[model samples]
Target: MITYDPHKWLDHFFDIRGSLVKEISGRVLICVFWSAGVVYFDKNYHDVNISSLLHTLVGLALSMLLVFRTNASYDRYWEGRKLWGGIVNETRNLVRQATVHLSGERDLVVHLAQLNVDFAAACMYHLRGAKIAGMLESQHPPLTIATQMTFALQEARRRGAITDIILASMDQNVQLLIDYLGGCERIRKTPLPFAYVVHLRRALVVYCFSLPFALVDTYGWATVLDTLVISYVFFGIEEIGVEIEGPFGLDENDLPLEDICTTIRHNLFALVELEHSEPDKMPEGL
Candidate 1:
């Protein structure tokens, strides 16, 4: 996602990158020009004035629909973020547990760490409907890595490297990872209702196009400015919803999956190194 200081008011107005202005600019311009034509025609040739009261009623309904659409999309986005946060925490907890329980078996600890990283990376790719370069062609890469993690824990238990209790604890973390993965998949695969989206967009178009007729009588030439501003607000809100609906994509507003995966890898490797060097030197808030 595009990072910025929200307090910087001037920068936001000047910044065009990753803004919804680009997406709605064309529509706003069309609305402005259409309003101008309507006003000119009404003044010179024929009157096309309509009741502004009708627009008032339609605008209220349109605002409610836009609010609902935006809220639903943001709910999916926030849920996805929360699920990934769970994954991050669980991965750390699992690795920290393994570091303590299997301290003597450095290779096994490293392997477990790498597996966790792989699982996260696989999950990122899987949600995006893509494949990592080295990952084997599998129906579900995250599940494959999850299975490997389970086997590793099982083998540790079988060989008496870790007790049954330790194995169970680590296995629980693995299950949580799968659960988070499922949550993410649900968000990515299940979109908003088709009829709802269709009706919302249709309402927006009808309202914005018909707004010029309502404003031309009172605002005259200024109807163009009013229509442009109103269209921009409505279109921008809808576009923002679409941008964040699927939070796994590469859009500037989408979740930073790539950076998140990289962070998990780095933290795991750092934890491994810390354990190897000084077991007592664990970080404060890992």
Candidate 2:
């Protein structure tokens, strides 16, 4: 996500890197030009009249559409954040359980805890749609980690390192990981409906372009700046919705999955007091 001082409002506004303004600049230019045309036309024949009465009704409808669109997209973004939060919590619980129950078998506990880190990272990679690469060359990294964790648990049970009660408690957290994975997948696979998106975008474009015509008659040449700002708001809101709706990808606005995954790894290693390579140097999927 884009990061800077929130208090530095001007700096934030003017910052070009990773700003949605860059993506919508071309559309803004169109609005400016369209408004200029409205000015020229009004100066000459004055036949073009995109009436204010019509705009009042259309504007209300368009505002509602953009509001709902942004709200729905933000809901998905928040939900995705909560799901990853769940993953972080459950992973910690599972590893802590292993460390506590397998007190005597530090090696086994260490192994399983390390695997939990792997599992968390794998899940992040899975959600972000990154193909497994390097040491994690598998179709399903999370599933692979799940399998290893399961095998280790079974071995611990067989060796009497953990009782049925402890195993069951640990299994609950493992189940939670599975649930988190499925929950994230559901969000990832399902998107805002295509029809809604198409209709809203088409409507927004037409409205922003036509706005200049509707307002210039009343506002005079000043309508250029007015239309430009209004179009920016409309387009920016819709574009923001599109950016966060998925909540997973390489986009600047996407979840910081890499950092989150690395944190899981570093925390797991610290919990076990097991030496690990520096997070920066660690291989991918670690």
Candidate 3:
């Protein structure tokens, strides 16, 4: 989503706009102040005696858990991408097949092609949690439209407009479209489980808050700086996982759902446009 020129290391470091800075800065500040308190408490009333070994063990355990959390989140993201990728490829195949087999039924083919495009947009809108008018399929507008398109194909087949082999091919693509919709819905509906999220958050918060106490005796006042950096890393990783888990929302890391549908719409129409735009090449004899 965020395109960049190849490997400008300095620019990446200084960049603030798209950085996780906004998300992590507040927590980083809290860590700094919390660390400062730990230092003051140690300087005034002796040290808290929190063991370095104890903190190291807890941090190690939490880090492993975070790794699992982030990995699961990224798995969902990639799954959503693959499902939508299937939508893109299968839609094009469907349109191309229609153009080949239903060439004589120009109007019908164009209408069906447009429906396919509509199905794509509706599918994305469904994923993004947007409400559709008339409440078709109760916010599952994509599925509703998909069914309509399939029925239309059935009618065409019954009318003897398309051959049996061609109908079978088109039906396969339609089934794929339905499967994609189901896959996206599965991701959207089932997020990281509640108990898992709760435990992870609680452990991370406890670990990060206790870190300064553990380090203050060793590093003294420098604990503030260290705490900020460490907090940024821990919180940033989790925040990134949260943002990308859905892969359908407005987050920059989320898939570009609208753009994908827009390109497909353009392509489907363009495929049809090519036929009308230029006259067929005259035969050599003609």
- The most accurate candidate by TM-score is 1
Worst 10 residues of 2 by lDDT: 274-283
Model 2 misses residue 9 by how many Å? Answer: 2.6
1 or 3, greater by TM-score: 1
RMSD of 1: 1.8
Model 2 per-residue lDDT tens digits across residues 69-95: 999999999998999899889888888
TM-score of each: 0.96, 0.90, 0.92
lDDT of 1 by residue, 1-286 (tens): 9888889989787788888788889988988888889999999999999999988998999899999999999999999999999999999999998898888888888999999999998998899988778676688889989999999898788778898888888899999999999999999999999999999999999999999899988898999889988999999999999999999999889999989999999999988888877546666775
Off by over 4 Å in 2: 134-137, 274-286
Q: What residue pairs are clashing in model 1?
A: none
Compared with the true structure, all predictions reach lDDT values of 0.91, 0.85, 0.84
Q: How many residue pairs clash in each candidate?
A: 0, 0, 0
* Model 3, span 53-127: residue lDDT tens: 987888898889889989999999999999999999998998887777777778867987898898998887788
Full candidate order by lDDT, most accurate first: 1, 2, 3
Selected candidate, larger lDDT, 2 vs 3: 2
